[model samples]
Target: MRKCLSALLAALAFIPGCAPEGTGDLDVQWTVGLTGSCAQANLGFVAARLETLSGTLLARRDAPCDAHAVRFRDLPVGSYRVRLSAFDGDGVEAYAATVSDLSVQEGIEAASCLARLTPRPGTISLSWYFQGGRLCSAYGVEDVLLSLFSADIEILAQSFRCDRGAAVLEGLLPGSYEVRLDAVDAWGVPSHSFAAGNLLLRPGHELSFDAELTPCQGPCW
Candidate 1:
């Protein structure tokens, strides 16, 4: 009888005394824009990861970018970190952003998370000139229209009223670009045209180019 009682006591000790507290829910939404020049159709997935304050991963959820939201349920009440990422159709990460010190409470929902992401950028400085002095001196070609294009012929950036014979294009992604400039007369009509192509820009790098315009005798098309 004594041996049986001791064995029963040992077995009861191994069992848990009480159930764990109920978990909470975490809802996250990205309020900011994504990085890269890819189209939305190329974006394959959006992912969110929850981790403890000490960097212990707790849960992860992935959904389509068009799903509009992400939720992690049954999370213990504590502080955590959330990371968000957008992946392309080829499984390549196009953009990533994170939020820290998120608090979750028992039986309560924690929402209102916002993450902002920015792509790597480069710079382009362009200066314009005319082959004949008549375009600038006689016609007074002070206002110019400038357009920047990607290698695939996509319009990446543009500017109007570019004065001082110079224009600066900023926050451009690293790639090959082409420059197109049109001189505007007092009546806002295009009088001259110039083009510079195959300019390479790297991340955090600056590129400078010169555009020499020729007078349009007939119609500036």
Candidate 2:
């Protein structure tokens, strides 16, 4: 009886780390370049799981330009397929782009950034290929939340369930500001932080920052 109880306790002790088996650290970053020019556009990064694709949505929520690039980090260990879309400045639906055979392993940085250009402004959209590293029936996260703030720590805008993997902050007063992304886990723990340094933007022109959130707990974990 003592040995049986010991074994049972041991299994329970490992369940938190082993059960569900979907917990891990993931970080991503990206940048976009204007057409026909070397000038680059920046997109923020995010920390998410393979299941966060369900609520992935895109809107022509910014300005002109079409070319964009994205990067993923600390993803789960599995394969993935990425889907993309193009939108005009008016938020009109366009076409789709797909990438297959993408894989993510533990402890390795996955170069999941998608970079492509189209002639329309509102034609850009995004989605992922993996089912949260699990072949189970359900999909993971629907949409990740993004909060944009100025240097003064003022909230410019809060985008919820933003599918585009990018936000076009237009109508700004044209100045320098700081950007950060917030990442949450299944237990509602905010562990990652992605920040962009002094970004300069013009009133009419748009600026994008791909804030990639990674798994970063405090020293104690």
lDDT of 1 at 91: 72
**Per-model TM-score on C-alpha atoms:** 0.44, 0.32
Report the number of the highest-lDDT candidate. Answer: 1
Those runs of model 1 whose alpha carbons end farther than 4 Å from true positions after fitting are: 1-22, 32-41, 120-221
Cα lDDT tens digits, model 2, 175-220, are 6676655544454445454556577653234454345445456721
lDDT of 1 by residue, 1-221 (tens): 53454345445545697323456788887633544333532556778888865687888899877665798887754556888877766575555678887755576546457666333476898787777543364666657877778865757545455457787788778678888778887777888888778898754467887778887879876
Q: In each prediction, how many residue pairs overlap at the backbone (N, C-alpha, C within less than 3 A)?
A: 0, 33
User: Cα RMSD to native, each candidate?
Assistant: 14.8, 25.0
Cα shift from native, residue 86, model 1 (Å): 0.4
